[model samples]
Target chain A: MKAEDVIRFCGRSLAGYPLRTGLMLLAMAIGVAAVVLLTSLGEGARRYVAGKFTSLGTHLLIVLPGRSETVGGPPPLLGQTPRDLTVDDALALTRSSAVRRVAPLMLGSAPVSLESRSREAIIMGTTADMFEVRNLEMAQGRFLPPGEVGRAEAVCVLGQKLRNELFGNGSPLGAFVRIGQRRFRVIGVLTKKGESLGTDLGEVALIPVASASALFNRASLFRILVQAQSREAIPRAKKAILQIIQERHEGEEDVTVITQDALLATFDRIFKALTLAVGGIAAISLAVAGILIMNVMLIAVSQRTGEIGLLMAIGAPGKQIQRLFLSEAAMLSLVGAAVGLLLALAGHWVLARLFPEFPLSVPIWSPITAVGVALATGLIFGVLPARRASRLDPVVALSRR
Target chain B: MIRLESIERIFQVGDERVFALRQVDLAVRSGEYLSIMGPSGSGKSTMLNILGLLDRPDKGVYQLDGRDATHLTDRQQAEMRRHKIGFIFQFFHLIPRLTAAENVELPLTLAGVDPVARKECVAAALARLGLAERAKHRPDQLSGGQRQRVAIARATIMRPALVLADEPTGNLDRASGTEVIHTIESLNAEGMTVVMVTHDPELGRRARRQVRMLDGRIVSDSGAGHEG
Candidate 1:
């Protein structure tokens, strides 16, 4: 038959059962909308975390000291090796290559006095280069130079947020602050850099490494932070730095080099499975939609059995009847796809607005997925009805009212 | 030309075997206007269906123009029916969904005739049936006589040589029935073979050849010597 004839047949068949067709479309649309909404949420959360990590500068690489052993569950004590990084190890790695700067951190939490303003702060002793490695901008004055590190310079750079807390919009720079009987001058105020991986970078203070080492007095470095030329050369730069640290530690492999990209990649691997899991579950809804379509079509065929027999008796082929029903199925899915697209856009907009921190991504793939689900659902459900319609015995069918 | 020799049809109803037609033999030559007269349940409709190629006998030799139709495949029989046989029913089975013109055009369309040819042929068929003005009216819009005329037009649209009409006037009023019978007899006079089944003895006597059946067997066959 001609395409136009088939189209006409399909149109009339659908018109014959408006309510049933409408319900089929609604069911399919719901299934598609679920997939789009959930995937967008997952994408949004991933983007939020990735952005937070990147703003802290791509140069900084963290070397977590020991293996946690258990899969993200818990670190086993039996396989727990102590941290072997020392001040000397940090010094050794820092001096090798175009490794422009490095900082050995010794983090401690304490209550301090800043021009009569007292609050709890995370105190860290590190070289001025720690500011550069963390991409910290000085809002007020200068950070400690290399000549000032380990020289007992009673000077530190307070983050923009900490400065606000201590001085209440006043300049805390060029003022004396006390931490455990020691007085330090706040020479600079770090610029506003928000949280990275949930740690508020804007709330910490950095001082000379030697002074922090002596006060908190750790013979071993808590963690050595390194910065490279740019994000592109970070891997080459990290590998060289790792070799330098290995040699300095008498060929020990205790230090871990974790780059931002690698961490983001790991995050992707973790979330990829998550997205597929949700998407796969959404696929189950499609299967359910298919089943619903099939049930509706079967009922429709049974209702029209006499009409079908009449056509057959008048020389219409079994193939034609099957195609007519399948066409009806496709129309339901097509309309459902259109409705699902509109719904997905509204849902995505709401999700993005409600969770600004998580930038939900509604890629073209999301809507396309809706279409695929609809088509698949239509076919899966439509086949059984078509087959049943085609296989109907003409004699019995004609006798049915 | 059509001839049936020893035609037999047996249908199974539960554990009993019912014979619809048995040891039936007859000849219907070209241009013959003949009717098989019988009461209800005497196999008149079954014989008509078999003769129309809509059903087949379990044991028989059916020759249409000297070719054995009994051995032909279902598809082949349908093709032969499409090209050479026309059927008219008592209720005037003009498809309700189609207009008078389109209902007549169905046979030509099924034969893969081009649209231009189909249009011209359909217009001619409707005009000849005196329904040119009502060509676009569906069956429901037409009177009983007009519907039967439309059915006649559709059956003869393919110019089939033989027409098998079962109780062609059974559903019509006497005048409408007379009009329908006249339309069919005129076609037979134009050299088309017509085999009609009717219970009305007055109508049955009008055929040049009258065949009678009782108990699944032909009891008598009488005809004009020159069927043409």
Candidate 2:
């Protein structure tokens, strides 16, 4: 038979039983939709994390005290220990030409009070360079004064939430707030910002690194934030900081330096694998849909035995009969894929509206792969039924009721 | 032209070989109108099936239009059937989903005839069968006589040289059966060979050549003496 005639015949056959065709299409559509929605979710999570990392400032490096790697050698008999990372070490990192600025962090929790209203807040002590390194924006007043790194300034900046709790929409700039037996003038109030890298910047207080060292009674710094002069300078700045820290600590190389690109790349790899795994799991539904197609097509063959016999008697080749049935399957799969894509798109729109902050998006290749697999499964599963129809004895088939 | 030499067809019924046709030899010249008449289970339908290429004879040298059809490949047989043979059935096996015109167009469609030519041929065929007004009606909507006429139109749509009818009037009423038989007679009169299988003695007598079979063997043939 001609190709168009075969297609028209199969289309008419499928359209003859609307309920059966509809249910089959539904099964295939759900299979494809599940793949798209689940993969989009995994991809959305990946992008969300990547976005958070990007917001931490480009060409950045973080230095933490203590070596993160394990050494295989035995301990020295003299009891050698890794020294602490201090403000001096943080300052020494600025000597390199590739290093743009550095912020040495000191963290502590203390109660601040103004006229009997008291709230315990996390206090982060850093220098004025922290305003640029951490990408902080001031809602009012200026940031910490740029001066000596060790200068114990009696002024501090309050986070948005902390300022609201301490002052309650009143002007908090220049107001003295007592903290840990010391009074400091509020130099600035931070703008509203969300969590980044597990830290809620909206709820902490900022102070001079020297004053936090005195108040907490610890010389060890928490972390050092290093901003490279350019994107290409990140590795150079990291090497210089590690070398400088090693020299200051008697060549121990105790500090761990992490570049933003390396961290981002690690996260990117993890999420891509996660998306693929979830997508693979979702593909199982498509296999089930394929099986459903096979079952339905088998039933269709038996149901139309008389028609098949008639065609055979009218000189339709077995191969032509097979082509007719296979094209029916292909048409079903194509329409089902289209419906599934629409369902996935609608689902994505709803989810994006529900969670606007998440970078929810379907991976570009997912739809193409889902549709390809669907078509492949349909054709593969269609083979048995088409073969069965072709192999039927026309005499016996025509005799059937 | 059609020839079958010593055709033998056997059926296995619960492990016992039963002969449907035994040593059945028959020859039909072009444009002949012949009918095989027998009781049920006498292999009349089997004879018709073998003639139509729907069944393969176990032992026979069947030739059609000077070609050895008995040993042809399945594809070659299908091609031969498409170009040279047509079939009519007792049940009026018109595809119910199709209109009467599409039913008549089936043979040409299967032959890969293009739509414009197919439509023209179908219109002419249906019109020749006196079914022009009923072309748009489905099989269920048409009466018994009209349905059989549609099947006749379908059978001759490819203009085959030979037509096989398996009890074509078995399922119709008397008037419809007479009308269908007349349509087959007219086609035979136009120089197309017609072979029909029927149990009705009255219907069997209308053909120019008559064949009677008993127990898978031909018992009598009116035209055998003249051919010999």
Candidate 3:
């Protein structure tokens, strides 16, 4: 028979058993949909984390005072006391040719007042190079001046929200404000950079590192941010920073130098594994769907034995009989896979709308893989039933009522 | 021409081997109307199944139109059946899902006939069987006589050289049975060989020659002179 006629014959048979066909389609659709949606969510999470890290600037490295077992993890607890990283160590790191700029950091909280209004704010102490190293933008005025290392200059920059609270949109350049019993002039107002990596950039107060050390009465630095000259120089910059800091700390590797690429790569590997694991878990359901197809097709074959015998009696070859059953399965899987893709797309759209902050996206290969797997499953599982139908004794089948 | 020599078919019913057909010899010439009559378990249906290649005898040499058909492969046998044989069944065995026209077109379709030729041939066959007006009706919607006419059209659609009817009127009333018998007689009148199996002596007597079977062996043949 012509291919189109065979397809029409199978189509007519399926139409005769609408409820059974609908059930088979539903099972296959759910299988494909599970694979698409689960993998999309996993891929979305990976992109969200990658986006956060990329926001910190390119070819960057962070130097923390204590050592972490891995680049991206928190520092160990209750270990041997590590040598402190100081302002001198930060200054020594800039001598390396691979390093472009460095920002020595100190963190503390203090109350600030302008005239009578007062509010407590997170205080970030860093050098003037922080503006270039961390990609911070200035809305007005200038950043802190490059001066002597221990000169405790009484100048500061304010985040956009902090400036709004302290001066209420009024021009506050050069206006003196009190921070931790020390008065400082506001040199710059930072543009709104939003929240990133748990730090709300719009709400913090920035000051000269020397003044912050005196006000908080501490010489130990929290972290030192370094920028490499180029993408190729990141590893060189990290090695140089470790050597400089280790040499300054009596030849002990007391600090951890984490490159932004290393952190991003670790996160990339973890999320890729997560996506595959979830996809694998969802593929189990597809196998179950395949088994269901087998069961339903077996039942269909037995139920239509008379019809099969009739076709044989009318001179259809055994191969043609098998092809008829297989074509039925292929048709079901194709339609089901199409419906599943549409459902997954609709689900992804709803999720993206519900959570605008997440970078949700379905990878290009997912739909193609889903459709391919569904068709393969249908064909493979359809084998036994089709074989049985083809091997039936025509005389016996015809005699059966 | 048809020939069967020393045909022997056995059925193992648990420990006892029953002989369905034993050392039976028969010959049928072309363009002859013949009937085989027997009681239940007399091997009439078994003989029909073997002749139609639906079953293979344990020991036999059957020839049709001078070709050795006993050992043909499954595919070769199917090809022969597709081109040279047609069957009409007692219950009309029309696929319930298809309309009369589609059922009649089945044999031609399986032979890979083109759509234009298939349509023309199906229309001509249905008209010959007096089913052109009922071509669009499903089997359930047609009366017994009309459904049998549809089956007759399906049987002859491929223009087979030989037609086999197994109790073709067993499920119909007397009037419909007579109508179905007349339809088969008219086809036989066109010089197509007709071999019908029936237990009704009246129906058997309508044929030009008759063969009687007792148990698994043929007891008598009235038309041995017509053998090719």
Candidate 4:
């Protein structure tokens, strides 16, 4: 058929049953909008979590203590329970070709004192490599060296928040401080690294790991934090580290290796499942829209049986009869898809405005899927009625009063 | 040529089959004008329907140009109706949604005649029917005489070999009825065969050959033999 004829047919589609077409489009639009809006929100939450983790030096790894041995619970790996990683382990990992830096991380809360001011602060103890491992830069003085570490120097680097609380933005470097009854000199203050994953990074102080071990006096190791040269070497470095750690433990495996890729894959699966759930729920309403289209088209077939017969008697072939009606149905679906796209866009725009940090991510694929669904819906649901129209015996139909 | 042999048309109202036409034989030569007349249930409409190919006789051989048409598929019969046979109904069945010219133009359109040629033919038919001025008016807008003339224009637009008009003027008064009959007869004069069914004896007698049906059978056939 010519383009004009196709356009004319679509016009007929609208004029045939304006109310029904309007209602079906509305149903599709509302359903699509809700799906897009809710899915975007979920995506935004995932993005925010990923962003927080990304801020703490994308390469940093946290290793926790192995499980404690209980009476009848999980078995120990490496033939040991609650195995403690030591400073030597961190040093061993750094020697690998892929390894860029390593830091033994020790964390505890301590009441920090400066002048007459004292505030409870989260304290981190690590080698000078912690600066490179975390991509951390000091706002004042230098990080303590290995000489200072070996001597167990009474010097500390204060986090920006702790420094500000003690001295209100004035230079706090070279100030005297106390942690757990031990006097220390504040040799440096760290550039502000704000809250991450809801843990305030600003309220912290750094010292030598040996000094921390001496001060805390609880020598069970925490974890060895390591960074590889690049993301490409992370997995290889991890594998080598695991093997070495294994060799050190007499070939007994205790540590679990994790990567950002693995974690992201899990998130992908989770989001995918959520997408299916959302799409499935959206499709229920779409199914209702399909039913509405079908019911109306069926009623239309019955009503136009005579008209169909008249056309057939005049020489319209069975296929043409089927095509005309089916075209009408398909046009309805396309209209629905268009309206659905608009509604989805509108919903996304409104939601994105409400939360600046939460981005409403509109994937181009979702609307394309909706359009495909509508087309399939038209063909599937419209076929039966179009067939009915095509199958009507012209003689009987035309003879009707 | 048109011929009907041993025609029987049985209708099942509910349970029993009633033969609307039984052992009915009739014919009309090419270009002949004929009318079949009978009471309501006496099978006049049945005869018209069979001759028109709008229906098939239950037990008979129907020939158009000596081709047995009774065995043709429904689509083939519809094509025959489209290109060779035409119908004019009493109610003036002019497709209320279409203008008079469009209704007149429908048969040619269905035949897939080129649009420009179809338009020329439609214009010629309208001029012949003297409805050139009323072509744009829909059936509801056209007067009785005008609508019947439009219907006649539609029937003859294809220059079909046969025109089956069932009570074409049964719904019109004499002045309008005469105009419609004249329009149809003019086509017959131009060598198109016309077979009409009507209740009015005066109208029935106007045809060159007259058929009288009674009790599901032909009672008399005048002015010609049983083959055309």
State residue A3's C-alpha deviation in candidate 1, in Å.
2.6
How many clashes in each structure? 1, 0, 0, 0
- TM-score for candidate 3, residues paired by index: 0.90
Put down candidate 4 lDDT per residue, B32-72, tens digits, no spaces.
Answer: 89888988999988777777677788898999878898998
Clashing pairs in 2: none
Tell me the deviation in Å of residue A92 in model 1: 3.3
* iRMSD value for model 4: 3.1
Off by over 4 Å in 3: A69-80, A110-121, A137-195
> What tens digits encode model 1's per-residue C-alpha lDDT throughout B1-228?
888889999889999999889988777878888899987778887788778766788998998977888988645765777778887877665656668887787666556577788899999988887999999998899999999999899889888899988788988999989999999998998889999999999999999889888778777778634442
Q: Rank candidates, lDDT, best first.
A: 2, 3, 1, 4
lDDT of 4 at B8: 89
> Model 3, range B25-53, lDDT digits (tens) per residue?
99999988999999999999999998888
Count of backbone collisions within predicted model 1: 1
Per-model DockQ: 0.16, 0.66, 0.64, 0.30
TM-score of chain B of 4: 0.96
| Candidate number achieving the greatest TM-score relative to the actual structure | 2
Q: What is the TM-score of each candidate against the true structure?
A: 0.74, 0.94, 0.90, 0.78
Candidate 2 residue spans exceeding 4 A from truth: A76-82, A112-119, A138-141, A161-191
Write one digit per residue (lDDT tens) for candidate 4, span A71-96.
Answer: 57575554546456776666777678
